[model samples]
Target: MFPIRDHNPSGRTPYITYTLMAVNILIFLSYVGLFSDERALSRFFFDYAAIPARIVTGDGALTLVSSMFLHGGWLHLGGNMLFLYIFGDNVEDEMGHGRFLGFYLASGIAAGMIHILSAPDSIVPVVGASGAIAGVMGAYLLLFPKARIDILLILIIIFRVFPIPAWIMLALWFGMQFIGGVGSDPNAGGVAYWAHAGGFIAGILLTIPLWLRLGGPGFWRRTDGHPPHPEARYSTSRIPKVRR
Candidate 1:
């Protein structure tokens, strides 16, 4: 499923989130052409992406930060950006631009550490902002649990857009990452489930102070677990019809 939009609107502009998305896309496109040269791509990943073993030995420390800007492929970049785009703005609005940027980086670095712990010996270079974006999802789940998100579901040829509570979507995502991390071997490269899970948990914890400052459970009551503003309404009739 893919989330197309959220009902809640941010109180302020999410400049930091937008900047992050731009930087990640720019960095990925900078070296995407090397995909045809397997060796070059591998070398590039090793140098710029997060390698668990290299991290454990105090080497390639820069990758903990650099890797957050790199991605595996077009789909990888797209998916991560989509998630970040969906949930990041609200958190960024709540935290303010400067703090949000710092929070994003901190969450990503923490995620990298968790991934390294999961596979200290694996040489597979970790890429993508999923772990960091997972952090945003975690915070969003806590900050606006009752907000509605429109998710596009695809089953064979049957397609539908369903609106569901933010908590449900974010919780399900976290559960998947947790289960995947436990069931899969980190030494084998694919999804860095542990990193996603760790980042998500970290995001929640890191946002606790802000949550408290906003009055904790009282904040929930004030906004009813949604952004404190009017939701934007779009007309479905505006959609264009396609025919063969």
Candidate 2:
């Protein structure tokens, strides 16, 4: 299922979130062409993307930070940024711009380190903002458990949009990542499920202080688990009649 949007809107402009999304998209566009040239692309990733083995060997220290902004493909970049766009604004608003940016980077670096520890000998490059985005999702879950999110479900030829609570969707996503991480070999390259999982948990733990500052359970009572703003209204389209 895909998330079209959320009912919860940030109280502020969320400039940081917008800037982050634009930056990631711009960087991806700059290097997407390299993907066509295997040699050039490999070199590009080697230079900027996270290499777990290199990190374990104490060589690619900068990649832990740079890799959060790099992505391998359009879908890879799109999906990660989409998640960031959806959930990042609120966290940014809550943490303020500066702290939010620092939190994002820290979560991403931690994610890369977790991957390196999980597979120290693997030579594959892990690239994407997913780990950082997962951190945003983690924080969102703690702060807005009852917020309604619109998820688009595709069942073969059928397509439908369903509104579910934030906790359910985020929890399910975390569970999937855990299962995927356990089922696959970290040394074998595919999805960095462990990074996603670790980032998520880190986000939650990191947000604990902010949550407590916001009055902890009292905050939930005040907001009723939704954003502290009015929900947006969207009209449904009528199905068109087809001639037989």
Candidate 3:
């Protein structure tokens, strides 16, 4: 299942979210050609991506931040940007642009650290905004658990778009990451599952203060566990129904 959008809308413009998307896209374009040349790409990743082994050696500290802006490929960039696009706006609306930017960076940094800890000796270089976006997902769960998310699911040749509660999707995503982290070795270097999980936990903890400031359970009671605004509506998909 892939999330296409959310029913909740932010009251204010999400400049930070838009800007982040642009920056990530631009950065990926700058280096995407390197993918055609494996050695060059490897060098680029080592220099700019978060290398767990380098991090533990007290070097490449700056890469923890830089790496969040990088991605392994087109799909990597697109997937991360899409999630950020879907969930980030409302979070930014709640946190304000400046604070939201800080929260994003902090979560990403924490995620990189957790990845480093997961495989301190691994020389593989990891790059993506997933960890940070995972943070946004985490906060979205805490802030708007009942919000509706429209996800596109494809089975064989079947295609369908369905809406589900935000909590279900986010919780499932988190659980998959946690389980993946337990099953895989970061040294093998595919998905940074630990980073995703760590960033998610960090995001929730980081948002707790804001949650409390907004009135904690009182806020939930007031908003009824959804975005603190009217829900947006979309026309139903044109896919024909299956004949029974």
Q: Give the alpha carbon lDDT tens digit for every residue of 49-97 in model 3.
A: 9998888889999999999999987788889999999999999999999
Q: Which order, best to worst by TM-score?
A: 3, 2, 1
On lDDT, who's better, 2 or 3? 3
Model 3's alpha-carbon lDDT is 0.92
- Per-residue error (Å), model 1, residue 47: 0.7
Backbone clashes in model 3, listed as residue pairs? none
Q: List the residue pairs that clash in candidate 1.
A: none
User: What are the TM-scores, per candidate, against the unseen true structure?
Assistant: 0.95, 0.96, 0.97
User: Each candidate's lDDT (Cα)?
Assistant: 0.89, 0.89, 0.92
Candidate 2 has which clashing residue pairs, if any? Answer: none
RMSD of 2: 1.3
Task: Tell me the TM-score of model 3.
Answer: 0.97
What global local distance difference test value does model 1 have? 0.89
